[model samples]
Target: MRIPSLKLLQGFEAAARHGNFSRAADELCLSQSAISHQVQQLEQQLGQPLFRRVGRGVELTVAGEVLQQSVRRALDNLQGGLGRIAGYMDPGLVVLVCPAALAQGWLQPRLAELRRALPQLSLLLSTDESARFVDEIDVDIVIADRPLQQPDVMERRWLRDGWLMAAAPELAQRLAALPPERQPSEAGLLCLEDGFTDARAGELFRAHLAGFRRVGIYDDARLLLDAALRGEGLACLPKLLAAEALADGRLQAVAGYPAVDGAQYWLARIQGQPRAAIVAEVYAWLARQTEEA
Candidate 1:
């Protein structure tokens, strides 16, 4: 029997892990349809149905579950082997992966502190949200909104963030003066599209202020913040990301709106890989940063 390609197996593994094609595609940095097609090809080659559509998501069939277990094991073995070798090859080099907003709004500003804490360690930071430990690439650590649930990864909740609906001071003043029951028809809603920064923007808007019109969708927190600063629209943004703007009066919190619970940031490291002393030092420093945050 001909063996399926590694890409096909990888796609199948990601889909099975996420149980949703779109999420799997996000993790693997592939288009949703591409992941779907790859999984379909794998099923065709195996001559068995792997996934059953359940509403908008998917459920694994018995065969799919069996295949998933095996696929996970096989991929884990390969990743572990490569990680072990890579760990020893560059013991002082540490790689960290996280969303761009986190890197920009949080980590970048604190780089000097990290460098001072681990003066001997070399740091490489990747802002790609798709970067994870399971792939063949070298990623020693990750800071993500979601906890790393893979058995081979160790995670610590780095920080809990909150989001506030905010707008430019002028806009906030206008909205605040409106009658209690009057909706702010002059302002439009701004949100992130496929946002990884704080994945609850839409939910927050829907739960608290669904009457507002959605006028703009961006893929970056900075863009949303910029739009709000320009008086283009109101946006729900991480408190930390907008702290400077709010303080300087470029943006102001929407009157009477409470902060929404944002996703927790996790500091995670891959397990079973060689742990250098520098890695431990860096991890400790990161934990301290969270404590201070």
Candidate 2:
């Protein structure tokens, strides 16, 4: 079947939504008779009556109601797509790519501070882990564990986390019952497979935790911390991620384990973007937050 004209469809859609041809005409800036004529044209093309005249107003027939739902949905989708395209072209928009765990544990809580610091900036947070440079993504900045080494990009160490072995209070108590030397052997370890920023740190972590029996392995810090909270095992996590839990008595540090220097978070951006100054401002604000962290 041939597709009906957009004008006819638009007229019918507006009329059906308002339940009055006159109001639809007013909204479309056309006369009521013009709206009636378009609706009649659409109905003739479809070989069905689209509306039933009720006194001065009109009501949609069963077929018209179905068409209205489809038309409204299509129009909404078109408008939404255009809005996203506009946002993509917006110069003030800053996109950030970072890990989901960090986004949830760190960045999300301090969003209000960021807003106050950069009132004119509009931020879009992406949890894509594979993007190496700002050009690789639609992002203005990248907050990642490893530094980007591209010539077109600049990176700086944003945060250096202090790590500690922690577990749920109940799990800590269970470990405490064992002798100092036997505790490491007896306790189950919740390990993060790729937690370190560099190979050297990963090697150090592996060497340090070699004595513990591995019970679980995770890629995400949040999941590792969650497992520890459930009394599943003792996990070595950044103090920044576990601070609130430790303070609330939900998790506690294991005795005899010193805080080790963990991964460094790096903030990267393209060297010569139009928003370079804005990126630097945000980078400085993040550094300030890290100092407080």
lDDT for model 1 comes to: 0.78
Model 2 Cα lDDT, one tens digit per residue, 1-293: 89887788888889998999999999999999999899988888999998998998899899988999999998899889999889876655778888787786667767888888888788888888886467734667888888878778877888776677888998798777876457777678887776544444465456766677878988877888899899888887777677668877999988766556766889888775536466678767876765775
TM-score to true structure, per model: 0.58, 0.69
Query: After superposition, which runs of candidate 2 have C-alpha atoms over 4 Å from their true positions?
Result: 1-8, 40-66, 79-93, 109-116, 119-122, 130-137, 147-152, 160-163, 169-180, 193-211, 243-251, 255-264, 276-278, 287-293
For every model shown, the clashing-pair count is 0, 0
Q: What is the lDDT for 25 in model 2?
A: 98
| Weakest lDDT window of 10 consecutive positions for candidate 1 | 194-203
lDDT against true structure, model 2: 0.79
